[model samples]
Target: MLVVSLIAFVMFRFIGDPVDQMVGLETTLEERAKLREQLGLNEPLPIQFWHFVSKAAQGNLGISYQFKQPVAKLIGERLPATLELSFVSALIALLAGIPMGVYTALRRESILSKLFLTISLIGISLPTFLIGILLIFIFAVILQWLPSFGRGQVVDLGWWSTGFLTVSGLKALILPSITLGLFQMTLIMRLVRSEMLEVLRTDYIKFARARGLKNRVVNFGHALKNTLVPVITITGLQLGSIIAFAIITETVFQWPGMGLLFLQAVQDVDIPIMSAYLLMIAFLFVAINLIVDMLYVVVDPRIRIGGGEA
Candidate 1:
């Protein structure tokens, strides 16, 4: 995470100058120099880096040249929307992926299973942007079921005025969420099916069968439990990627989330806002992985204690 942060920081600072960009080519030489000094752009690289880190540690994060507001405050205001989208997207992905994976695994040799596999493969092959567009075409253009772009008013700690879990919000969400979730679900489905298959072939599962254990208990209780470690790990990693993807999807959907802000900031070369946004995303990714690690220990005792003891 620190390495990624360093890379993002170095790229943003050294790759270009916000001062020069804001100054424009028409500005006089003296104006450019003055603006550079004003924004601390004239400082030595080491000093500038220190200044950024020190101010960041103190919760400053500098001020945006475009917005004329503290970067931290600006990010804080936008953070909720991003979080809302991310959580909703993840929920949709997991809900769809896990069950699909389980069913595919249980019926791996069936024609239906093969159809699912084909669909999953195609889904995994397609890009999110393409999927987003396709979804918009069907649901937005043809069906006239929901709005194709833009978010509704966020009120009452919810994304839609109808409600967070209401039919309207969920209906609006289906397209974007499924578009975002498609690739991830495809990947997770394959993983879960393969893992469950391996677990089902284990000697304990055979023994349980010999003992006349119910198929549900053998499959869901026994095989599923053993397969959870890898599922949990992959799910955590995918969550980080999903947040990044949601940024793109949000822009495609014209949603007022952190992703749209990041896209605009990049286009306008708003370095301060971009930098702060990148840092926040970095923190979210690290925090999510940490939570997943903790969950791993709780879900599987072998990871917590010495494997030899087990």
Candidate 2:
């Protein structure tokens, strides 16, 4: 994670100086130099990097070039909305994908199974932004059932209340969540189907079937339990992907989340915010991978046994 963060920070600096961008073209070179000095950008690259790293270690991401606020404070304010969107989207993906996958694998050769496979393929094929647009057109325009953009003004309600799920907020989420979820749904469905099929061919599953156990019992009880290990692994990976995609999906939906903030930062050359966002994303990826690794031990006892004979 440290290496990744360093690379992202170096890349952002190489891209351009936020000091100059913030100061504008009308400023003289001397004035720009002063601004650079003020921001510590005029120091040697390695020294500047070290300074930023030290500050970051102290939980200070420095000041935002755009907002002139501390990056940490800005991130703190926006983090909740972004996390909310990503979490809700992941929930939508799991709810839709897991059942569809189990059903498809159970009926492998049927027409409904073939249809699901086709849908999964298409879902994986489409870009997230395109999916967001299609959803917005359908739900927000044609049906007029939901709002097309922006979070609602129901902020007075308590955090645990349904304020975020109010008419406007839910409408704003509809496009982004579905858009981000479709691709993840495809991946999970395929993983679940393959794992379930493999589990069904195992000795225990075969024995259960031969022992005259009901199809539901053999499939759901024996096969599904084994299949769950891989499902859990993929779900963990997708949680991070969901967060990354939420950036794009949120932008497409014009929802006020980290993705939208990152987009604005990139366009306006807000280096501090952009670098902070990049580092935050790298951290999330590393953290999620660690969690997935730990989950494997919990979900599959065979892994923890080191392949020992029972």
Candidate 3:
């Protein structure tokens, strides 16, 4: 994560000046120099990086030229929306993908299984932006079933509130969540099928079958339990990618989340905000992977003892 932050720091500082985006081209030379010094852009790269890391360690992520607020404050304001989208989307994927994967794995040679595999392949092939557009064309343009864009009306509920549960909000969420989660659903489906097949071939699974266990017990009780490790790993990693994809997804739908903020920040060369965003995401990925590693001990005790089987 430190290395990733370094890369983002070096890449962003060299791309363009935040001053250029904020100020007019006709500004006096002295004023431009003063502004550069004010933002610490006139410092050497190494010195700038040092200050950045030092300030960040102290919980100061610098200011955003776009919003004229601390980068942390802007991110905090937008984070709930992004979290809401990710939760809904991941819920849809896991609920739909797990069962679909189990059934298809159990009937790999059947026609229905083949059809599902083909559909999964197509879904994995399509990008989120294209999927968002198609959904909008169908639901927003043709059928008129849901809104095509925006985060809908803000629902106030005191400390922490989201508009997603309201009627209008639900309509607004449908397309973006589907758009964001389609790839994850297909990915989880494929991972589950592969893991289930491997588990069913193991000695324990075969022994359960030979012992006259019910088919459901042999499959779900033994095989599925064993198959969850990889599913959890991939799902954890895929959840990180969801944040990255949300940039494109939010841009397509105009949802007011971190992704949209990042997009706008990028366009306007908001270096402070961009650096904070990149660093935050890098930290999130590290934290999520650490959680996944810890979950392995709980899910499969054998893994805790250095054996692959539990």
Candidate 4:
């Protein structure tokens, strides 16, 4: 968090002047100086960073120069959309990827398995923006099935709003979610296939087969279960990547999410929003890793037992 804060603060020095963005051509030098002073842009770099860090620790992310609203408030409004998109994307990846991986591993010689492998390769090879564009062309343009952009109609529930409650909202999510998740799905599929093949070759798997355990039991109950630890780690990291890199997909879809906001901040040099985004993303990465570590114990008792022994 500290490192991220430092980087974000340093951006203010080189990324154009906020005062220039805020002031008009008619503003006098004295007015610009006063505005700078008020915004603390006139202060020493170290002093400004210190103030930023101290206030951020207390949940005060400062106000955006562009929006003229609190950074936290802006983020809070956008966070749900990003999270919902990411959640649905991750769910699609796991639900489709895992089963396909298992089938491909078990039926490597089958034509259907070969076809799946080809599709997975395509998913991995296509860039996200291109995939999004293709989906829009097919579904929104030619087929005229789903809406091409926007969140549709969002329903507000007190402090939070969501798109899941509306028909248009769900349709709007399909293209973006598939675009964001395709690479992750391919990755998870490949990893699972490789892990399953390796696990099947192990002595324990052979022993289970010798013991006359059913193939389904030996494959899913044993091999699949053992594959989950590494899968959990990768999935956790990928979730963070999805959120951090959702900028491209959001831009392509014009989704009102944090990634889109961050892109706009970059264009306008809105330092407060940029800084808050970095800190929030870093915190999310840290939290996800911690959760992955905890999941290790739950998924594999061996990890807990080994730690206890150590």
List lDDT for all candidates, in order.
0.79, 0.81, 0.86, 0.91
Q: For residue 217, what is the lDDT in candidate 2?
A: 91
Assess candidate 4 and give its TM-score to the true structure: 0.96
Model 3 alpha-carbon drift over 4 Å, by segment: 156-161, 306-310
Q: What lDDT tens digits, residue by residue, belong to model 4 across residues 1-310?
A: 7898899778856688888888889999999999988988878888988998999999899899999999999999999999999989999999989999999999999998899899999999999999999999999999999999988899998878899999988999999999999999999999899999999899999999999999999999999998887899999999999998899999999999999999999888898899899999999999999999999989988777987666
Ranking by TM-score: 4, 3, 2, 1
Task: Give the per-residue lDDT of model 3 (tens digit) for 1-310.
Answer: 7787787778668877778877887999899999989988878989998888888877688998878899988887777778788878988889888988998999989998898888889789998899999999999999999999987876866645586668888778889999999889999999999999999999999899999999989999999999999999999898887876788889999998999999889887887888888888888788889999999988988778885453
Residue lDDT tens for model 1, 1-310: 5565566567668757677677667999898888778888777877877787777767788887778788887776666666666677778767877788888899878887888899999898888898999999998999999878765544454422322555555566667777778888888888888999899899999999999999999998898999889999998999888887788788788866678888888887888888877777787789889999999889888778957776
The C-alpha TM-scores of every prediction are 0.89, 0.90, 0.92, 0.96
Cα RMSD for candidates in order:
2.7, 2.6, 2.4, 1.3
- State the lDDT of candidate 2 residue by residue for 1-310, as single tens digits: 6786698678768887576568777889898888878888777888878888888878799888889899888887677778877887788888888888899988988899899999999999988888888888988889988777776543544332232656766666666777888899888888888898888888999899999999989888888888988798789888987887788788887877788888888887887888888888888888999988888898788788877877
Candidate 2: regions farther than 4 A off: 24-31, 154-165, 305-310
Worst 10 residues of 3 by lDDT: 156-165
Return the top candidate by TM-score. Answer: 4
Q: After superposition, how far is residue 225 of candidate 1 from its true place, in Å?
A: 0.8
RMSD to native, candidate 3:
2.4
Better of 2 and 4 by lDDT: 4
Candidate 1 C-alpha error for residue 253, in Å: 0.7
Residues forming the 10-long window of minimal summed lDDT in candidate 4: 8-17
Q: What lDDT is obtained when candidate 2 is compared to the true structure?
A: 0.81
